[model samples]
Target: MALDGQNVCRHHGGNAPQSLRAGERRVTEERARVLVETYGRKIETTAAEALLDEVQWTAGHVAWLRERVQEIESEAAVAATDREHPLVWGVTREKSGGEDRGTTEEAAPNVWLKLYQQERTHLVKVCSEAIRAGIEERRIKLAEQQGVLVAQAIRAILGDLDLTVEQQARVPEVVPRHLRALAS
Candidate 1:
């Protein structure tokens, strides 16, 4: 569908009514064309940098949490073995019949299981928090980059229009009589 000044201007009907002059409208259209042509390349570079920053920030936190969980698991395994072979680890006592022997085999305690589970849960929480923080940081960076890209595009457009100021100032004189009548 085609858009016209009437439709575009309707949004600001109540406050400080304003309209784009013919030359200004041409310049604005040129600016929009330039932005469309150049914005993607600029945004792509910015987004890549933002993503890298986020990855760098999160990598260390993730590695530390993984190492901690691995340590916890190793300790839990050792504790389980100790519970099963108390004599093997020198924790057994001799029986009353003067026979040197080991104690009955017992299953690993529930406390060890609980501790392992808790440590695993904490590790997951830490990893998740790191990921969320990374994502948030990346989003912030991307938003900032997008703002810079937009501003750069505007400046570029202004610069191009500035170079054509003299030529653009002569457009109204070339306007057709029919178009001028319609404007009136």
Candidate 2:
């Protein structure tokens, strides 16, 4: 049957047809509300799951890195031990012949000091060489610049004398000996 806006449904006794325009509007509104709620819940759930996974992965990586760091530290400590001879912190003479007992810490500082001194010596030599090279390069550049300035001064003198190119080139040969010596 063709149902209008106020038409009543047969199944609901006196209730209006849910398929009518007004009824459809209410249904559409409810459907939209449901969709928004479901979509929001799914988004929140996915974000929460991703965050948890990231936290788990980061914790695992940090734990692994920590273990590796500890292992490296232990290896370094063992390698730092001096294998030359047993240290003698104090001497003990009993029924036994002789025994030396001490911590290896005393020799470590001396070894490190020698290494530092050698490194300082190397650094000084390198720095000195670098400075010397820089000074030499600067001297060379300055000499070249001075030569250019001298040449320009000579050209200006020739120009002031109103000399042509040919005259300028021959002035040295035509000048008196005393004048040439004074110019030189």
Candidate 3:
């Protein structure tokens, strides 16, 4: 496969005339088909810098959306002062063809109200997702802190116990295996 100008792989035809880069490998369609059937597709997400940039951009976008929600000049509360034209209408049309079918039209409230609610609902969901991501990040950080303390305590205890050299030789191999979960 080849990485091309549009990020498309050459296996499916690259965006432009292309050639593989120095360390690039190609997978045959037959091998790829079998691999995909068993384990799904191979995709890339190994770029940590890209993920960080995306997170920053999303956070900025959320703040901007929040400000837009607050900064909107609402005409919702203001009563209609124009008495000259009162033929206000909200039209909805539906059609059905069957023995017992009828029109399915609905009369919704003002479009502005619907938009306001939709925007606010979207904001709530995005805020919730951001909050959960933050909490997971913090939880991982705390676990790392605790893992360090545990390692230190284990070392200190080993020092206090005055174990034999043969016994000391076994600790390094055993400790890391047990502390693996906390490292993440």
Please identify model 1 stretches exceeding 4 Å from their true place.
1-45, 81-184
Candidate 3, position 48, lDDT: 44
Per-residue lDDT for 20-130 in model 3, tens only?
432133445546677889985646654443344455666666666555544432322254433321122233444477674565434554344455566666656655665
TM-score of each: 0.21, 0.23, 0.30
lDDT at position 179, candidate 3: 73
Question: Positional deviation of 15 in candidate 3, in angstroms?
Answer: 83
Residue pairs with backbone atoms closer than 3 Å in model 3 (clashes): none
Best by TM-score: 3
RMSD of each: 29.7, 28.1, 16.3
How does model 1 fare in lDDT? Answer: 0.54
Candidate 2 TM-score versus the reference: 0.23
Q: Over the stretch 41-64, how does candidate 1's per-residue lDDT look in tens digits? A: 345455445555545545654566
User: Please, what are the lDDT tens digits per residue for candidate 2 over residues 1-184?
Assistant: 3333334554543244445657667667878889888875534455334444444555555555555545644655676744422221222222433354343243232333344455555555554554555644665788789867866887688779998789977866765454557668
Please list the residue runs of candidate 3 whose C-alpha ends up more than 4 Å from where it truly belongs after superposition.
Answer: 1-136, 181-184
